[model samples]
Every structure is written in C-alpha cells, then in structure tokens.
Target chain A: MRHLASILLVLLLTIPSSPIFSQGRVLEKKQVALWFGIRDITRDSLANTGDLDFLNYLHSSDDMSEYQYLGVSAHLWFRGNWEADIKVAMYDDFAPNNLNIKAIWLPMKNLGFTAGIYTYPQLMNEFNMFHRLTDVGFFGDTDSNFRQRRVQESGLTAGLMIPFSYRWLHATAYINGGVSTLSPFTEKVTQKMINGNFKREIRYSTSHSPALFFFPEVELGADCFTFGNAMAGIRVRASWYTVNRSVDYGRVTYEWTYANPARNEVDNPAHHFSKFEFDAGFYLTW
Target chain B: MRISTDRTTRITVLISLAFLLKAVSSCIQPVFDFDFDFNKITVTNLDNSDVYVMRNDRDTMYSSAIAFEVTLSDEEFLAAGSLPKAETAFPGFTPATAMSPESLYHPRHHITALRIVTLEEMSPAIPAGSDVTGLFVAYVPRYSEGFLYIITDELLTMINRDFYPGEPSVSFQLFCNQDITASRVLFAITVTLSDESMLTAQTGIVNLLRAR
Candidate 1:
C-alpha cells in the first residue's frame, strides 16, 4: 500500500510539472490533465441452444443478472502528441474490479490512434459483455475469486475529434474503430465414448481469431464561468461492437474395448459457441 | 494579401488524405481465442424420495415396474389420508396400450409421475408396532427388443421459476436425462444422484436378469 501511494504521488508531481516546464519552451504546445468519474456496467450472457439440445437440459441453471459500478481514471499527456492513461474500477455485484493501461498518439490535429492492455481483478462490464455473447463454457455461476475470463487486447484505435463552440457551450464529436483478440484461459476439451464393442476418444481445440468493431463518441458541455484556472464539464459517450466467436463442443463416437469394459458414459461433451455488445458511459470532467 | 485558389485546394486535399489514413489505420480485427468445451454432461436429483427397481431389461417391452413401498413404523397401518397431497395425486400411468410402454422409462416420464408400479403385491418388512414414515419405489420401464444397442441422447431443459413479467426469482434448474434403451422396450434401468450445482457424475445401470 505504501509503495502504491508513493507511485501515485510521483505520477501526480511529474505529470503536472511537465506541462509547467514546457510553458518556458518554444511553441509551448504541451498540456497535462487528470479527471475522475463514476460509471455503471451491465452485461448479458450468450445463449446456448445447441448446448441445451445435446445436454438434454433447458433453463439458466445459474444466475444471469445486471450489475453496476464506480470507477476512476488518470491520464497524462506530453510532447503535444502522446498520452498515457490508467483506469481502476469496481462493481457491487461479485465485487468485480479491473486495471488497464492505454497509450494514444495524435499525429495530426484531426487524427489519433490508441492501444492498450487490461486485466480484471474484479468483474468488469466489458468482460461480461464479451462472455455473454461469445463464451459457452461460462454457463455456470462462479465465485469472485475465480478468474473466469481475463483478456489482453491490442489494437489501433483512431478517432477524429470535432470541436464546436456557441457562446458558453462547447461540444466535441468523435468516431473511432479498432480490432481486438479475446484469449480464453482454457483452450481444449477431450471426450471418451463407448459404443457396441469399441471405445473412441475425441479432442477439440480452439484457436484465437480477430474481431472488428466501431466506436463513435460525442460530448456536450460548457466551461464554468472561469474560477481561477479551473473549469468543470460533463460528457456522455456510447460504443457499439461487432465480433465473431467460435466455441468447440468436442466430438462424439462409440468405441468398444476388450480388456476393460467401460459401461458408464457421458453423452453430451462440448458445444461451439459465439455474440455483439453495445456499451455506453457517462462522466464528469474537471 | 489574398490567398491563392490553388493553395486552398491543396489544404483541402491534405486534410482529406489525413482523415483517410486515420480511418484505414484504425481498421483492425481482434483475435479471440476461446477454449470452451461443451461436451460435459451433468445430472442431479431434486426430489427427496428414493427410487427402487423391480424389473429392467432391453429385450421385453413389458419387463419393468417402479414400485413405491410405504411402511408404517407404528403398530397401526396409518391411513393413506394422513399423507401429503402428493400421495393422492393421480399417478398418471398411461397403460402400455395407450402409448409406447417404452415411454414410461424415459426420464421425463419419471419426473412427471408421482409413482409408477404394477398391481403386484409387495411385502412390508416394518415391525408390527412401527408406523409407516416413508416409501421407496423401484421404477422399471417395459422395453422392446434390441434397445440396449441404441444410443441415448442427453436433453437439457431450463425451467425458469420466475419467467413471468416482473417476477423476482431468477433461480432455475437444468435437468439432464437420457434414454437407457435405444429400442422401443425402454426398460433399461439406471439411477444417478446429483445436486443443483455443477452437472457432473454418472448413473449406475442395474441388469435385472443378471440379478435374478
């Protein structure tokens, strides 16, 4: 805990100080800012109909419900074109938590790109959204300590931010696109079957594939009547994602053995599963 | 000094090219690796009653019956009136002539019926002074020949207790059942115990002819 506090103190002192130092340099284009906000997260699980048929069962058999959370983020900008940001968030249900690091580059005034990696110490809405639409093995309920789905995503995100001002009101409209990969923790399933006088075994393995999606963000706010060098504003944003997923439900067969006869057999082995998600968040910037 | 028309055109083209490049660079597809295997089968028993088997075979369609024996633990044979409402509920036993006798062996039929038994007499081993506190039933389905060679398929059924609009309860059960006999006889007898948690475990099949 003390080490974390020291790290945070260093970041705070350095990030704000860099902008001040740049004020004495030529062009003086550098800027540094930090903002914190709260957000709510919701998720849905992907439906597994084919699994139901093979398993000879129907019903959720587990809890699938909506969840909400509060989160905080810190961002640092430097060299007029590069920025790095980190976020920490937690949910009430299951006490889901997450930490992420992101880097962005703006080569020109109208264009920007970003990449990032993230992990969930607690449940996150983004992870839940992906699992509900793509994961078949996430069928049963799990405890908070169990790391069901922890993913690393690296993609080029580009956006154009258009600024408009009318008297006291200022608005920004942005659009972005990117591709990401979701790597599952468990990658294979093996099944053994017995039929007549033969015993057969089959194994199913899944590989990683890329998913493409688009995001458009718009915000409208106003600078509070100047209070020294400080101002406050609020913004709302939403994103829509489209991705494909494949879940391999293992193979089936009947094989008989002579030495050891196996009478008990598991009938339904595995399922191939895949879904799309739309997410929106609101934040207050100061 | 006025700006030249050629210079304005150059600026417009440069802005357009920058936007185009940004859009192209952002076009990325994420790779998703999913290692989910759905081949596992899970079974569970929710009812408190224990099941017993009188007969089970893959060769004959009329070979099995599920018997529910009620024993009085006290000296008097307690009247059936004192039992729970489930005791008086219609057993819903459709005779073999009505439908396929093999259907009785299906797990769906077993869960739906309160009791399944032939009219055969059963001996109660309780002491004369003991009152009947509980009952055990052994259910056997009459099967047609060549049933054992047939493969049984698993079925997953999701029953939402609160499926109605504005309902509160989100709890539900996934019941997994398989046909023991592949033929029309359906008299194959297998009993497995399970809970409402992770669906795992195997059922034991009893060969009645071998026992006899």
Candidate 2:
C-alpha cells in the first residue's frame, strides 16, 4: 500500500508544471487522435450469477477478461473552455466496442458535461467446459457432443468529465447514466457422432431489451512529446458499466427432429451483460 | 465571416449526428431467443409392444411348449427374414400354418439364422416382483427329428426397459445362427420370487411350415 501511494504521488506530480519560459506557441485547433491500447475487463458481484459459472470451470482466476483495441477521436475546440469530440474504438478480438459523440463544456476549466451514444459490446465463447459427455465403454463407437455460449451488448451514455491537469500531466474521471440494450445473445450445443453418419445442433438466446445503466470511467496519463506538428501521450483508463437486473431469461429451442418431434421450448434465466474494463494505450494527436 | 463560421459549425454538427446515428443503427441486429442442437438419439421405448413374446403370455400358458410357425418361399427360406416385433401382441406372431414356398425343396433345418425378441411390460411401469430372469432357446428340426442347437448364455441379452417412445417395460433379445428346418423351437423361461415360495417354468414353440 505504501508503494502504491508513492506511485500515485509520482503520477500526480508527473503533470507538467507551468512553462518556465513565458512564451506561447500555436497548436492545432482541430485535431484527430489515434490510440492503441490493451484492455482488462472485470465483473463485480455479477460473477456470483450462475451464468458465469463457466468462468470458474474454465480456470479463470476471477470473472475478468482482457482485450486490445484501437481508438480514434476528432477534437474540435469551440469558444472559451469548450470542446466537441467524436470518438470510436474497435476491439482487436471483436468488432467495434465503443462509439460516441459528445460536447465537453469546461465552464470552470476542469469540470464538464459529456453526453452521447456510448455502446459497450462484448463477446465470450467457451467449449466443452460442462460435464455433458462421460466416457463409458459400453458403446465404443457412439457419438459425443458439446455446449458453448456467446453474449453481446450496446448502450447510450451521458456523463461528466472532470480533469485534473498539472502541466503535461493529465487525469480525467467520468460518470454517466444511460440505457443499454443487450441483444442477439446466444448459447449453442453441438453433437458429433463417432460413427460419422448424423449430428445435432441447438441455440438459445434472450429477447433483446433496453434497460437503464450506469457507466463510470477514470484515466491517468501524461503528454509524451511534440514532433513535426503532432503530439503524443501515454494513457491508462478504466471503465465500468452494467445493466441493473440480476438475471435475464430467454426461450431455448432445438433444431433436430426424428420420426416424431420432441419437447422443444424451455426457459433459461441468467445474468445480463455487464463488465468493468481497464486499458493502457498511446494516443497520437495530429 | 461570422455568418460563414456559424454555417460551417452547423454543417459539422449535423454531419456528426448523422454519423453517430448510422453507427448506432449498424450495431443493432436481430436477437434470437434460443436455438440449440443435440446429436445423440436414445430409445427408451419399443415402438411395437404387441408383436413380441411377452412375459405375461408365457406365464398363463399351461403346456410346457409354446409354438409359432412361419412358411417362406424357397428364396426367403434360404435368405434372412423380416425383423421381428413383440410376439404376444400379434396372433400371427404365434404358431401359424406355414404356406409352402414356391420351389419347395425342403432342406432339413433350412433357416440359416433366427432372431427372437421378447418384451416384458409391467403394470405400474416398474420392475416385476417375480420376473422371468432369462431365456433358453432350442431348435427341434423336422418335427422332432433332431435337436440342432440350444443357445443360452452367449445369445440371450435381457432388455428390461424400453428405449424409445411407446416401448414396453422390459425386453430380451435372442439371436441364433442355426439351420432351423425344425417344425418347432422351444423356449423355456423361469421366474423366481424373493420369498422363494413358488418357482414357475414356462415353455413356448415357434413352428415353421411351408406356405400354401
């Protein structure tokens, strides 16, 4: 803890001090910034939900997953201490993870309201982690099958951006509220017969619905350099957002039928999509 | 200059809003509630309960012999027959007049192979108190001219429970690879109870005859 506090203090002081030379230089008023980063996502009490039981089965230390992404934002400085920015980020593993357009009104230099469409998208797949097929030597050539699940999400976000800037050192904290829609969520089961004659497939999904959500973000970073009409910085950011519900239920249907059809529909209730993620990346402004 | 600047700002804001809307719309896709597939097929019940030799039918018979017959053409007599079903359920499954085959050159014990499937149906859908635990198969060739074979251990696999929908409670499958030109074959099954008070033995016959 003491070491952690020392690191925090050093980070706090890393913000550049007021320029020693009393000379002002012109910087780009309208600029585009690109960022490459690594992201770590963690879930809160949400992990207690049984839907995430596979996490424990798969030897995940906890309910956390990591990703990498590229982020692009265009900043336009308006009048006074106000800036309008549009940002879009795509994750390396999945598709576009976040996209939003917001106006930051810094009336008091450090505090501002940031609002726009902030969609959080996530995907997870685990294979054969469940105890479905047990090896019994009775029928040596029988077929064996497995199960897997995938989840997706999107949301609209509005919030406040508070920056603590000291020279080149900069830190921002944000809190937002919005509606999140988790859709196209699917869980699948597939069976492969050893005889190689037949197979079976089934998929389950929750009906998509929009629910209220809370999203908060914190970033700590410092400007790195200015080279040939451009600026660069290293930033570490963490964000958390989730739907308020405990479990989302859905209808499950089977895709196979023999001579006669079997019972097909069942109700599966589980937790909704929610995650807390941390990312560290370099941002280049041009 | 101020008017032009205002106009440019309006255009930029409009374009930004349009882009955001398009991205949001693109992200939206149809949500499927649940879809799944299973590869295994398990039979918990037999489809034809009436066609097989049943445990109850054997118990009621007084004679030590149960008999049924099938007459086949020369081609069928030499070739394998149709798959058998629950015997007790079909009167035709029992001893019936065999019509002589088209080219009846009656070879002694002409049947190259025979498969007997027996089904046991419980009233309350449970095990029997005193059940016929096993089966013994003997083929009497040419109306008792000679006994060809009796298959007990290796050929009898007791199937007690149903595997598919509409199946009986318990079933036994017996496969015999013997030349059964015999007019009849006898099956002797014994039922024993926990009290050890009464032990019942039953017998049945399948008589083979030439089709008319």
Candidate 3:
C-alpha cells in the first residue's frame, strides 16, 4: 500500500515539469485530476435463446438487478495530444475489483482515442465458493457445488472520445472496443492435492468477436471554484457498455447405475451482456 | 472508339462463359453409394445382475429374446410387437424360477422408448436412474433427415443386484425380423454400471440370423 502511495506522489510531482506542460507561452498541457464516484451496473442482454435454454435445461430463471460499484481514477495530461489515465474500482457483495489503464491520443481538441488493458472478476457469482454463508436459494437452487471463481483479464482496449463544453461546464463522451483473453474458473477437485498447479487455459475462440463498450458521458455543473492553482467541481456521469462473453469448459465424464459410462466434450456457451451504469462524483484539476 | 467497342464485347463474353459453367455444375448431382451393416449385436451388463430379465409385474419375472429390424417403409417398422415386449405372467413357476408363455399380452409390458438427447438434457437426468445404454445406428437418406437406430429395452436389460450377488452379468438377444436392403450396417452399444468394475476384459460374439 505504501508503494502505491509513493508512486502516485511521484506521478503528481513529475506531471507539471514535463516538456509538454507549456501551451502558447503559458502552462497548457499540464493537468492532474483525481476523481471518485459511485456506479451501478445492471445486466441487459443475454445470448440468443439463452433464457429459454437455461430454463429448459437448468430449470432456472435469469434475474438481473442493479449492482453498486465505487471507483477512483487519476488522469495526467501532457502536451501534443498525449495523456495517461488509471482507474480502480470495487463492487459490493460478490462484485470483484476492476483496474484499467489507458494511453490517450488527442489529434484535435475535441476528438481523442484511447488504448489500454482492463482486469475484473467474473460476473457470475459462485454459491459454494463465496456465498456459502448466505441462503443457497439466493443464487438459485442447484445441487451442483461451485468450487472456483477468479478474475478475468481483458487484454486490450481501443476507443474514441469526444469532449464538449458549455461555458464553464464540460462533458465528455467516448466509445471503445477491443479484443481480450478470458480466464474461467477451474472445477478440479484435486487441484489442491497438486498444490494448485492447475493453470486455467485462456479461450481464443471468441477473439473474432471483439469486446465493445460505449461510454457516453455528460458532466453537469463543471465550472465552479478555482482555489490557488487547483480547480475543483462536482459532476454526474452515466456509462453504458456491451461485451461478448465466452465460457469454456474442458472435458466431462459421468457414469450412473442405470446408464452407460459416457465421455463427451462440453463447450462454453456464447453470451452477450449490456450494462447501464450511473455515477456521481467529484473531479479536481490543476 | 473501335478499341472501346472490342473491349466491351470481350468482357461480355467472359461473363457469359462463367455463368454457363456455374449452371452446368449445379445441374449435376453426385450419387452416394454406401453400405449398412446389421451383422452383430452385443449387450453388456451395466447394472449389478448375474441374469438380466425383462419383467412386467413387481413379483413375476420373464425372459424373452428381444428383436429389432429395419425396413424401407416407416409403417412396417412402427408395427406393434415388431419390437420386444416384457412378459407379464409366468405359467410354470418354481419359487425364484419361472418361464413365460410364448404368446401372451400384458398391459404393463411394452418396448422401451428411445430418443435422441443432447448433453444438456442428460445433465440432471444422469444422476438419477435413467438408462443411458442402448444401440446407436446412423442412417442417411437422400433428402430426409438422418435418424439413429436405437433399441431401448428390446435387446437389453438393466439388472439391479443389490439383493443378489455372485456372477453379475445380463444376457439378451437381438432378433432381426425385417429384410434390410442396405448393403451394410453398424451398431454401437454403450453400457454404464452402478459400480466401477474392470469388466472391460469381457467379450462375446453376436449371432445374426436371417428371418425365414
């Protein structure tokens, strides 16, 4: 934790002295902003025939409720249309922590592009693993036990951003899409016997369908106070995103008393999610 | 102007030639000549039982040679008793041993039903006492959907032997009664036992007899 704090302090001190800090014989590209916000995401779209398929086979209903998330981000602006940003956030209940970093390019004053990597936990909550203390019916009553659920790493992201302003208040809207490698949970019961040596394989079949997200943001009441060399304001933002989810399971073997011992291959179902989120937060610029 | 006219004519001729070739290719239908085999049938004992018998009542037991045959028309194959049915009552009874009549009809006795099931359908039903063993045959038709040749209880029996022990094996026979025009046929039998036993070493020969 101390190391993270020191790194943030170093970034704060060095952003102002960079060569891109000057604009038109004055400080133009130099800006350090810190932001904290609360966000809520709700699942929207599922796979084709996913609801009916799950109901007929698994005999369960799909429930989509709004989940709250708290996050912090730091932005550093440099001269010549170059900037860097980092965001870290955590969710409530079974929500996992998400971290993202991006290098942005601003060809013109109003338009920009960002490319980065993102990491977050799996959206599906495991009943046996985490919510064992809670009622089993909360996650759906199934005889199967959940053993493992882990974080998923979204390898890369590339998107475009557009910023608009009205007098002192400014609004920024962005759309980004990229391909990623996904790591699913391992269901190996003997995984511990082998000292957890089991390595989850990354699925590449869904790479053709690049994960896409659109963040159309509006900041209200942006211009207010300029304290010393720092500027602070309060704003409300809403972001909506969509992504294709691919779940892969290896080989399955089952034998019963009345049936034959069968060995077959099971593939992950293709799933898509549409999320709508709103966040209220404060941003500071210097 | 003359050069341009010649170039346009050449392009039109090439396009016409390509269309002619495609039309000719689409008109020709390739004939697929393949053989089906119905020569051998082997029933392996999946459950714990020395002798597997098709029984109707909870108390009475009967055994019969299960029969299966394939024909060209769907009506002939769907006829009742063309498949095997479990005998309901046994006339010659000697305590645990009895023989059923050759010609007897019982309400509860019927041929087992076999249908194609996906993996997801097998998930929940697998843990329960659902029989997953049977014959699987692949049949291909010219314009019709391909169907599997499956015999649920006609040629097999699932013996539950928690009450009896010793030589745990089930026996049944496959009787081919219909004339098959197909050149060759293939049959696959899958068996799952209640206990994990190394019975992979067991082997038996299937006798296929032509109907008189």
lDDT of 3 at B14: 96
Q: Rate the local accuracy (lDDT) of all candidates.
A: 0.31, 0.42, 0.39
Assess the local accuracy of residue A104 in candidate 2 as a C-alpha lDDT between 0 and 100: 79
Candidate 3 structure quality by residue, lDDT tens digits, B42-133: 33311101122122122111111222222111122223223222243322222221642232121112123323221212234333223333
Candidates by lDDT, descending order = 2, 3, 1
Ten consecutive residues with minimal summed lDDT in candidate 2 chain B? B39-48
- Give candidate 1's error at residue A30 in angstroms: 9.9
Q: What TM-score, computed on C-alpha atoms, does each candidate reach?
A: 0.36, 0.42, 0.41
TM-score of the A chain in candidate 2: the value is 0.61
Candidate 3: true interface contacts recovered: 0.00
Residue runs of model 3 more than 4 Å from their true location after superposition: A1-65, A92-96, A126-155, A188-221, A254-263, B1-212
Score candidate 3 by TM-score against the native.
0.41
- Candidate 1 docking: what grade? incorrect
Off by over 4 Å in 2: A1-28, A44-65, A79-82, A106-108, A127-150, A186-203, A246-249, A252-274, B1-212
Query: Native-vs-model 2 lDDT?
Result: 0.42
Candidate 2 chain A: minimum summed lDDT over ten consecutive residues — where?
Answer: A134-143
